[model samples]
Target chain A: MAKNKRDGTFYINPYLGGVLLGLVLFGTYYITGRGLGASGAVKSSVVSAVHTIAPVHAEGNKYYSKFLSDDASPMSNWLVFEVIGVIVGGFLSGTLYGRLKFIVEHSPKITGRTRLIAALAGGILFGVGSQFARGCTSGAALSGMAVLSASGIITMMAIFGSAYLFSWIFKKLWI
Target chain B: MVGPLIPMGVIPETWNNVIALLLGVGFGFSLEASGFSSSRKIMGTFFGYDFVVLRVFFTAAITAMTGIFYFDYMGWMDASMLYINPYYVMSAIIGGIIMGFGFALGGFCPGTSFTGVAIGKIDAMFFSGGLFIGVFIFSELYPLFQGLYNSHNLGGAKIYELLGMRDTVFAFLLIVVAVGMFYGAAFVEKKVTKVEY
Candidate 1:
């Protein structure tokens, strides 16, 4: 494995990583009958928070009410558990690779503060977009594509296409 | 035996969450090991410096799709029982555009960002906080976006059905297209000067 001089951690080959990911995804569908997701877990957390802080308000809202259930806590959802596992899994990988550290990763051209702001703003946009698209890159686009769903293909195209277009526009932030 | 064990009642419902946790571990480990925990590395696809995202994503998609098809053919699993995301023409495109903008700026998707958070990236934390706020805003103002959100509903439509092709045929073509893209990405990576993150 080739190590990065700065980080001292070696990254896996991309194609090999992809195959592993694909097998995981395949296994997920085989066992659970659904694809992997990330945004849904975040949505579940948001719903749980709102329900806790303002039950009346959460119940009053159509969108929030849809997720509010009497049987189980929103935080008790499968996606939530899955997200927790994601954190654990990520930590394990970091430990194995010696990539565990506290730092703001950014390009040299930009200040850490600038990078943080961009990350926040971008996350906000993704949050809003995931709702409209009904899923983010993983849930809607990738998972959807795996099943040959029209929604997944279209969303995937739109995401990559728009990102390619906007990357050129937001070139200063990155390159 | 029919597949989709949980949905088909082959796997007990009590084990659902446990399975979710195990699967998520795999999902997270794969993403992080692929260097998806880094925003700059993820952004490489857009910059022509690296095509890891393209390679991983397409490869995953095709591999899963192929697996499902094979399972269905062999009568090992019932593919029809699988869940499919509904198509809302306008919202999917519009939402995807917004996410694309976010990707350009933030450089990490929700899944990847969580992996970043695990590695102690402060920026990922803020980005996740922003996700909560964004979802809150969207919820609070759901009425304003309701019309567009519910406008076009094509319920669980398959790509092959829409294009008038058989699933096997479409899957084969997709594999071909994915292979082509992989080759193209390799070519592009060689031609472009590498940008060290």
Candidate 2:
């Protein structure tokens, strides 16, 4: 029988999973003197693509220019490398768990088209939001909370608080 | 040698990217193994039918925090050297709200979305593509939001300092709160109707 993702017991114990994730985070700090990040890779990719397409335009932009440097390519970002590894690791887990099928996951109430549109909208907002907060949930919230940073704590509160309220509003999206 | 061995020159600088890749492997494996690759599983936290996200997230936070604290106390690592995200009060709050909005709609964060893509979820691919476009839009419109983005900067502020609590005291309280949430989450999960994805 295929293991259902929703079953609380199908996956690794939450506490154990947390410890593994926490250890990875702790290791990240110990080794890199930094936390893990996700959205940053997207930032780097955007900068690199822009820089490649229009050097002058990219350099002229205040936001993109901040990442421009003569000595290094924005594509050589640490987060980019880490994200590649994330793909490999996720693949490994999916293989082990038999979740390697190509599919669109959605609530029965919604069509796949609806899920796609919502996913796209959500991703865009997250991209825009992470730039403002200077980090995403992983970088600012989880990583920050590990160090007990004021901004991280505040961002965590705001993200969860807002999401909790909105989830209710978007009740049909999930169930 | 200090714990942040790379900066301390205990580890060669050339290995930086290599280590990043390694750390990411562990990070991804943990998230996926924990069922984070599934959007429905993650959305469960908000729905009250499942508290896995809360359990995993808080447990991870406290676990790492505890490790850092103990390591710092032991003089095994220089916690002060760790990169603290700057507190841009207004921006952090506003940005977090926006990200939260995205979270509810998409059912995935940037990190989790990647894992979903790795597992071949089509919706995750759309989400990831949208991230690129969204970032591009933000960069193009940077001039308009620059003021709001950079406003109210507090440099590397710690939560304990902001809250007027000792570091140890705050850490202890966080642990207590996380544990309480775990229990409360279980209570809520039991009460709510389960939804099959």
Candidate 3:
């Protein structure tokens, strides 16, 4: 039904989708001994790019140095590969759902430019936050919750709690 | 192989990236198929228009947690061997707060943003680009935040242990909480005016 009736809300049942995602996560742990991640991939990319452009600076920095190692290129990391797969998978799904299109999704009240600026700002914040938390929603929050990690639960609460409060403050962004 | 095939040497290390790719496919498919490609849909969880994010997130967490428990109980795998991110008190909280702020502004987390980009959303591309800039800024300013970043490291601490409760008990409570939230979300969704995304 979700596939047939095509509109903006074209999607599978939320509960079913959740189960499928959970299974993938579970399989990831069973096979890899760790949870899925998103921000880590981006972090790695930043590190690798910086290292390539300004080798000495990347090495000198405490944070970038932490991720850089002698044995492998930062780009040759697990998260990087996983992220590439994520892109491929998403493309496949988009094609199947006939949802692939180049458009800016924005509130009717706001122009596309405003939406993009907000998105860029949001990305920057998320990027910084991911570094601080050592993960993002998927890595620290969801995956962490699955394993019952203390930091995971605390971080999860902080993210959702803060987001709930902030969403009210920025209600115009959505509604 | 008991589990965590790569780490346990049941599977060779070379297959690490290969496995990561395969699993990522599943992960991406799940998120996109669930409508995570739309930032509006994700924002709906907070605005109360659609509870898809809440429903899917809690359900997935519960399902995986339950699977881990059952597998460990049956001795099919060792849960302890699984890598848990070290619990850094100050940084984790601060990072989450900052990220939450971003979520409201950006309407997409890093994972979901990638899914958005996958579906050819121009906004998602900008968001992803911003992610790079943010990471660069943090890396450049790492010195100022170094003290806060490395401060309070509780390595791989489990929540149940910290709460001084049995694992099973804590897990049961979490499941109850998730189920309760699902009902609450459904109730809230009914009251809120639906927005066409």
Separate DockQ for every predicted complex: 0.82, 0.83, 0.86
Residues A48-149 of candidate 3 have per-residue lDDT tens digits of 899999999888988888888732832249898899888888888888888889999998878899999999999999999999999999999999999999
Which stretch of 10 consecutive residues in model 3 chain B shows the poorest summed lDDT?
A: B1-10
All-Cα superposition RMSD per candidate: 1.8, 2.1, 1.5
> Candidate 3, clashing residue pairs?
none
> Could you give candidate 2's per-residue lDDT for residues B74-180 as a string of tens digits?
99999999999999899999999999999999989999899999989999999998889889999999999999998889899999998889999999999999999
Runs in model 2 lying further than 4 Å from the true structure: A1-9, A70-76
User: Which of candidates 1 and 2 is the stronger one according to DockQ?
Assistant: 2
The positional error of residue B49 in candidate 1, measured at the CA in angstroms, is 0.5
- The iRMS of the candidates, in order, is 1.0, 0.9, 0.9
Model 3 bad stretches (over 4 Å):
A1-8, A70-76
Per-candidate TM equals 0.96, 0.96, 0.97
DockQ of 1: 0.82
Q: Point out the worst 10-residue segment of candidate 2 chain B by lDDT.
A: B1-10
lDDT per residue (tens digit) for residues A39-64 in model 2? 99999999989999999999999888
Residue-by-residue lDDT tens digits, candidate 3, B111-137: 989988998999999999999999999
Instruction: Pull out the clashing pairs in model 1.
Output: none
- Lowest lDDT sum, 10 consecutive residues, model 1 chain A, at A1-10
Model 3 scores a TM of 0.97
